[model samples]
Target: MMGTIQNRDKFLNQIASRFNRPRISSPIGKPNWKSQPQYEVYKGATQDELLEILKEQCKKIHTNFVTTDLKDLPVVVNDVVIDFGGGPIVTWKDERFSQWGLDSLMKQEWPEQNIDVFEWDYTVGNENIHKAEHANVGITISEITLAESGTVVLLSDQDKGRTVSFLPATSIMLIPKSTIVPRMTQAAVKLREIHQRTGHVASCINFITGPSNSADIELNLVVGVHGPVKVTYIVINDL
Candidate 1:
């Protein structure tokens, strides 16, 4: 902070002098990467097969996977709710979930306990919803699921807060089976295309594979140590 304009120039000059170089007065251009990849990242399966692979990989990593038709989403939600134990349920606002007819499903005859479901609309334009971080279950919509890694891609915006996936004890992701890609490379390429075509860049794009965990505590595995203890994926085939 104490350095002046002259001092900054002097420091650069000192380094240039040490290297026996001189400063050039010219504008620098951006670095150019290769136009094509040297080797391809193989996407070796069809959508159906990729979905199967994603489910298998998820099981191997201790992440739960559930396949249900759009009509049965509510039933699956209830099952997840039961296992999540009970605090509160937070879900997306008027997003694709509503488009796929999941509005009534969220409220379809659950236990008569005090558990409440907080749809994203409740917080719109100043709804003052509190204890959001304490919600037991957090549900989100993911457009892409990489089969090779069993990861779900979430594009964050004003409506889709990043906290929805990271703050709760259990996180549930709803992914359309049609969007299941065989590899991460295909997903990345699509994201890049979207950015280029629309000139719109999301603040955060999260690739979630499973629950937040760590094994650094004496090499002993710990779940939810960093964030949610459990992660579940509900892949919709009929969506």
Candidate 2:
């Protein structure tokens, strides 16, 4: 078993003695900055402006961006799945799928169209990983989106597997317009709020920017070296 640090305060006190200062055990608050430039970008901008910024950034990142209302989300998702070469598809077993009216698409429509869909089930253990590894496409919802970078943030939980984003050849990320933020600074602030309120946070948080691309191999840019070759961001406007 892992051991706990029983002498944490003692150790710190000793270090403080060496430095000729008293040990500070209190939790330190965030420093007040002279100029909070981080909030300057897209400041006072509406959600629509942020969405526009995200769209422009998507073009540079080579991510396919689509905008649709909640009413048409299922249809848009279906078209994306078919465009990405219909299943075997993998997705998180999230209630939001049903909340967003995607129950029919995942449960009935896909199967009826002869496409294999797999939802990440924690009870089955590694079987989820096996299925994700072979899936043609994986779908997930972005918990928070960074407009400046076109980044989708995913927080992993029991039903949400991280592999669903990286293991597949193609990934489809559902973005609710309400989740869009100006930049990472806003995203970090939101995460801190969650931890402060709940005293807990997701074990893993993934910030995916388009598909994987690397230039490590002889300096030649290669896509899909470490993750999906294609990435699509479906933004739900009416959500």
Best by TM-score: 2
- Residue-level lDDT of model 2, residues 15-71, one tens digit each, is 999999998878999998899889898899999999999999999888999999998
Instruction: Show where candidate 1 strays beyond 4 Å.
Output: 1-42, 107-113, 121-129
TM-score of 1: 0.77
| True-structure lDDT of candidate 2 | 0.93
Give Cα distance to truth, residue 130, candidate 1, Å: 3.9
What is the Cα-based lDDT of residue 194 in candidate 2?
83
Q: Candidate 2 at residue 57, lDDT?
A: 98
Candidate 1 has an lDDT of 0.77
Cα RMSD of predicted structure 2: 2.0
Best by lDDT: 2
Overall lDDT per candidate, in order of appearance = 0.77, 0.93
Q: Give the per-residue lDDT digits (tens) of candidate 1, residues 135-173.
A: 888888886778888889988767777777887778989
